[model samples]
Target: MRLKISLKGAVQGVGFRPFVFRLATELGLKGWVINDSSGVEIEVEGEEKALQKFLLRLNAEKPPLAHIYSQDVEYLMDVGYATFEIRESRGEGRKEVLVLPDIATCEECLRELFDPKDRRYLYPFINCTNCGPRFTIIEKLPYDRPHTTMKTFEMCPICKEEYKNPANRRFHAQPNACPVCGPWVSLYTSEGILKADRDKALKLVAKALKDGLIVAVKGIGGFHLMCDATNEEAVRLLRERKRRSEKPFAVMFRDLEQVSVYAEPTELERALLLSPERPIVLVRKRRDLASSVAPGLKRIGAFLPYSPLHHIILRSVDFPVVATSGNLSDEPIVKDNAEAIQKLSSFAHMILLHNRDIKRRCDDSVVKVIGGVPVPIRRSRGYAPMPAKLPFKLSRKVLALGGMLKNTFAIGFEDTVIISQHIGDVENLETLRSFEEMVFDLMELYEFEPELVVCDLHPRYETTRWGEVFAQSRGIPLIKLQHHYTHILSCMAERGLKERVLGVAWDGTGYGEDGTLWGGEFMVCDYRGYDRVFYIKPFRLIGGERAVKEPRRVALSLLFEMYGKSASDLNNETVRSFTQDELKNLYIAWSKGINSPYSSSVGRLFDAVASLIGIRQKLSYEGQGAMILEDLYDPLVKDHYAFALEDKHIDWRPMFYELLEDREKEKVPSRFINTLAKMCLEVVLRIGVEKVCLSGGVMQNDPLVSKIREFLEKENFKVYTHQKVPPNDGGLSLGQAVYASL
Candidate 1:
């Protein structure tokens, strides 16, 4: 008997084919396994018993990274195969496997590393078929060694033998390496003496942590600012040095036990911690480890090591360690040694260095529980470059230059949209250059050449600048996509929506085509286009950019608008912070139209309400006030807040005014958040669009999203949200690419 098997999903580059070949051979069966553009395929011609055994094992034991959605088998009469063989990559069919992100050292590799008799004992870079680098090391597709960063390191004799042997655990492991012939570790202070002794170097790092010293450690993807998680003094110092105030810090623990002490982990949470991606997951806090870890927040973001270096460090410490991105407030994580030394000089007391060159810079991915599912916060490292299946393939190749903040570009052709790793806001020169470089690298790897380019309608965005420059150089057509449209389209593309749905884009700000600030918008649209169906009433931001950080200013501005013209009286306490001269300039700028533009963003509304309720007064970070306010919403309350439907638009003035009344009446914070959530739901459903897609940076507010979801489900409406790409502008380019194609 002869049978052909098709394996789907994340079965590629994970040793799936090699495992199948070994299993078939062990079963005394003759078969061939090959990879294609879609997934893995196998053909077997052998005894019935052997074939049955192979099938049983194949279903039961797939690779750790391979997730088979379905496996189809077809039987054919005796088309004899003499022996088992592994065939070459066949790109003829849609059988592409899901390529996984790099994983930390596995149990088998760890055992080998610690074994006194093993050749790879104490090898810091030890890896095998079951674990090691994947996304971070690869320079191109097909995921072979020649296309990876490991190509520079010629395999030692033992490793070469293991790689060639089909029966070996290291068979065809592209990143297979040992300490003897792999990347080496080093430690250096600001004065610059490279310490080659790994044990001594790690000890120095640990000692620094113990002494309340901040150290910048070069991680698998990029640099991480490390400190003792338990020490409040050290945490406070880190917060001050990094200029991160009040925002929760993500902690890395040795194991799940350490995580359990800080937060409650469900079965899904446990699986996420152990998953190869090993992303930072936000969970409900069990108790405060220290006041500084996540000051004023009810939840904590925690993760486990996804690299061998990380494992060793965690093992050495035997406790949770704070491992946040090693960059100042808005910048991207530093990737180069010289850059790290220069940029982190002020932030770190010492640097645990290494000679291994990092060709790619990736940040740790973040996720949070929303309705019992992992929602991607910042998609990078473990989850980037890996294409999201578009609802429909593109008609022409296109490049999408995303918005200004949390910038990430996308290149799409045929069925795949390769979103670049998180390239921070392209506002500054260095960030713009980084964006260009990251784009060039990804394009080279994918061999992507664009016939057209898409950019934000905003003329001031650095992304738009690059798009214009590149378009002029290439003489390609450039399409200017509206910001909110992209937000809606991104959700549609992610959920594989075939038709138009209600798109709600509520955020801080976006440059509207009509030369005004946009953020609060309701649109009826698809990938091709959208019509602004509804919006909040426009209001002036008292001091322009100053209003974004200071919620009090936003609250005062909204109150002025809501309470009619006289509410702008300078003597009012709401507007008391600004000086007379400053107030005069702001009023003139807003009233006579100098620098201010009217905005109707829901995010601004949240900021205003949060400030009015005294939930958050001074903004220490971007979205800090809103994030903390969101963290305060208690789901135990079951009351509905009121919002009225008028002229096909859901009016928000009523809710804000009501909240102001409640505040005057001294209502609880939980009641305020619950009421606001109720109002948002009423507004969403009032539009009469049952299929609602919620997105925007502000949607990352878990409390708001969770409550809205609950209300929508109760109303028997299907609510669509961002499960793949982030709801923020980091996810904008993918949506832009999708819309541009349409």
Candidate 2:
């Protein structure tokens, strides 16, 4: 009997072809395995029993990194062949093949790195079929060496032998190389003058890191500015030079044990840290470290070394080290050696350069455990370029340009949607350039020409403007989606849901259909369109965008709403912090409605409460006040303050008054948060929807989400939140793509 089989999904660049070759040869089968534009293809000519056994073991004994999304098999005519072989890849077909995300250095490759007897020992570019750069190195398709940056490096006889031998682990590895023939590493000062090369360069880079200097080390995806996490001066210097204030930096530990010493990782978080993706996991801080590392945050973003070079550096250092993206604020990560030297010289003391070129700029992914599941906060690196399977197919290609903050874009064709790796805010010129490059790169890789372009409804967003330009240039139609509606749709798309859902979206700000800002929203939505059913009580933003940076302005606005301009004279901490002149000006602005925009934003409410409770008067980043509010939560406080629902509006003024009265007696951030959760539950019940979807950046708050989910589920409602994608604007593009498909 003869059979032909087709396997799709993450089968390319994961040793799938080699695994099939070995399996067929061991079973005494005459067959061939090859990769095509769609996926992996295998043909076997053997006995019926052997074919059955092969089929069973195919999935059971496949490579660890291979993920089978679908498979098809059919009987074929028996054409006798001598032995099984791995054939060259076929490039002509619909380009539906899954591109593997960059993988961390496997245990076998790590052993080879440190083994003195190994030929590739201490080679920075060492990788095998099972691990190392995949998406970041490949410029085009078929997942072959010729299509990657590795095309420049000619493999030596020893490496060529390993590539052709199916019995070898490096068989058909696109990046297979050795110290004699592969890409080499070099060390240089920030000024681009070479200091050392190869093994000596690696040693010197490690020594520089140990001596408390910021070293810009090139890694799998992009360059990382690294320094000892325990060195206060080094951490402070990097922060100063990078212009990053208050936002926590992700620290790389030597291993899981060292991570546990600083952050209390749950079992799931530990697994996430050790997974092949090796994303930075947010966990509760367990011990004190450099004060400048995370500042006042209660949690730290931590991860283990993902590459051999990272492992070597971390192993050399006794303490954790800050491994942050090597770009300045609001810019894309540095990918090219020349660009790194030119742009990052002011921030980095030395440069660790490599010859392996980075084709894509992917930042490290970030996740946090919520309700015992790891939820993506920033989905990139190890989880990008992989398409999300849509429930329905698209008639034509669609392009989705995400929102202004925490931006990510997507391209959709047929039943697959490939969302780009997290692109930071596109407001900056450099980031916008990176965004345009990514759009062109993805189109080239997937052979896609979009028929329609989609964007947020906000006309002022840089991404929105870019989408309009792209659509006009292509002579295609442009679709605009309301920001909160897209947030809910993103969650719905991940779940493949088509029915109407009661979606509660709570974020900092989004452009609403009514020409105002909407954040706290209740909507009845399906794929085609949505009906805004309810929203938070409208409040005046005292200083427009200035209120976002200063939470005290929001507090004053809320106070003026309840007590008039005389409210500014109240003896509250937030009120007293302002000068009498500043207070008078703010009160006049709120009372006269000058420079004040009305908003129904739950995020501003959190910021207001945070300021009224003396938690944070100013915010350095979006959602900083909310995050601090969550951290200050006390689970034991079960009582909630008062709130009211009038006509379709959820009024929080009563709650604010209660908080002001209880400020001295029962003052706690937890009580305020619990009240908000209960208020959401009340709205959910009033909406009377069995299927509820909670989304938006505020939903990233673990305790708040857990509380809302717990309350809703207890009432027999099916609660849906984000897991595969972020609840924040990072996941907005997926929603736009799916909405356009509908």
Candidate 3:
């Protein structure tokens, strides 16, 4: 008997063909396996029992990196005369093969890097079929070396032999190379002066970091601005140079044990840190290193080295290192070596660069353990270009332009929605160019031409304007989706929920259907549409966009709502932070509605409380005030303030009054957060929806999200939160794509 099988979904660049060939040979089958534009294709001729065993093990014992979405098998007449073999990949087909995200250095490669006896010992670019740069190096489809950065580097005779041997780990590995022929590292001064080459370059770079000098190190995804994490002056200098005042920099530890010494990681967080994806895990800070590294935050983002070069650098240095994305604030990460030299030279003392080029710029992914599960905060690097399977198929390809902050776009065709890696904020020209470039690259790679474009309804959003222009240029329909509605749909799409769900969408700001800004909302919705059933009482954002940067403005607005102009004279800490003229101007703005936009955002509410409690008066970044508020939360306090619902609108003024009264007695931010959770429960209970979906940027608050989930589950309401995609705007594109398909 002969069998032909087609396997799809994340089966490319993951050693799938090698696994198939190995399985066929073990079963004593005679045929071949090949990779085409669609996916992996295999044909085997063998005994009935052997074929059965082969099929069972193919699914059961396949490569750890391979993710088979669907499989089809057909019987054929025996025509094979030769033994099983791995064939050359074919490129002609409708390209549907999922591109594997960049995988971290596997254990096998790490062993070889440390072992002096190994031929590839101390090789900074050591990689095999199971691990190495994939999505970042590939330029186009079929994932061949000719279409990658590795095309310039010719493999040595030893590597060529390994590439030919199916039993070898480097079999058909596109980036396979040895120290003799592969790319090498070089160290240069900030002014482009060469200092050292190869292994000596790495050693010098490590020494520079130890001496409190910042270095720009090239990795699989992009360049990372690195400095010793323990060096307070170095961290402070990096922060000053990057202009990232309070945002926590992700630290790279040598291994799990080293990470454990600084941050308290649970089993799930430890696994995420060590996973092939190698995302930065947010964990409780166990020890204090540099006060400037994280500032007011109680949790630190930490991860182990993902590449051989990173491992080598960490090994050379005893302490953890601050490995931040190599870019200025709100700009795209630096990918090109020359680009890094041009942009980072002013800040970094040295440049540790490699010859391998990065085709796509991917930032480090961020995950936090929420509700005992690792939830993605920013999905990039080792988890991009991999499609998120849709519950329903689409007849036409669709494009989704994500939100303004933490932007990520999506392209959907048939049953798959491929989300772009993190595109950063689309507010500036550099990030906007990155957004357009990645959109074109993904479409070109997937051969997708969208029939429709979907984007947030905010008319002023740069992304929305781009979508409008794109749709108009292509003569396609543009679908304007409400921002919070998409947040709900994004969570629902990931969970495969088609029915109407009670959605609690809480974020900083989004354009509402009525033209006001919305962030806190309770809606009954599905993919097709949503009904805004309830929301928090609308509040004015004094000074409009300025209110976002200065939470004192938001606090003043909340106070005005409660006590009118007299509110500014409350003699609170927030009031003291502002000058008399500023306070008077804020009051006039609230009273006269000058540059004041009305918003019902739960995120703004948190910011207001943060300001009221004197935790943070201004934000250096979006959600900074809220993050500080969460850090100040008193875990022992379980009490909540009072709130009232009027005509389905939640009035938090009562809660604010109670908070003000309690402020004199105790400064507990947790009580305010708990009251918000209680208020959500109150709304859900009133709405009488059994299925609830919680989403939005505010959902990134682990303690608040956990509290809401716990309260809802106790009421027997089936609560669903984002797990596969982020609950923030980073996952908004998936929701837009899924909603457009429906």
Span of ten consecutive residues with least summed lDDT in model 1: 663-672
Say which candidate scores most in TM-score: 3
The CA lDDT at 575 in model 1 is: 62
Clashes per candidate (backbone, < 3 Å): 9, 0, 0
C-alpha positional error of residue 614 in candidate 3 after TM-score superposition, expressed in Å:
1.2
User: For candidate 3, lDDT tens digit of each residue in 1-742?
Assistant: 9988999888877777888888888778999888889888888898989988888999999888899988999988999658888787788889898899999999999999999999888899999889999999998878888889899999989999998888898888899987999999999999998999998998899899889999999998899999999999999999989999888999999999998899899888888988999999898899987888888888999988999999999999899999999999888999998998899998899998899888999999999877677789999988997778987897678999999999999998888899999888899888889999999999999888899899999998899999999999999999999999999999999999888899999999999888899988999997778899999999999888999888888888999998987887888877888888888988888888899989999989888888888777889888898888787777677889899999968998998898888844344578888898898888899999899998999999877988888888999999998888899999999999988456
Screening candidate 3 with a backbone cut-off below 3 angstroms (N, C-alpha, C), the clashing residue pairs are none
Misplaced by over 4 Å in model 3 are 663-667
Q: Give the Cα lDDT of each candidate.
A: 0.78, 0.89, 0.89
| lDDT value, residue 617 of candidate 2 | 92
Ranking by TM-score: 3, 2, 1
RMSD of each: 3.4, 1.4, 1.2
Candidate 2: where are CA atoms >4 Å away? 664-667, 740-742
Cand. 1 TM to true fold: 0.90
CA lDDT, candidate 2, residue 53: 93
Indicate whether candidate 1 or candidate 2 has the larger TM-score. Answer: 2
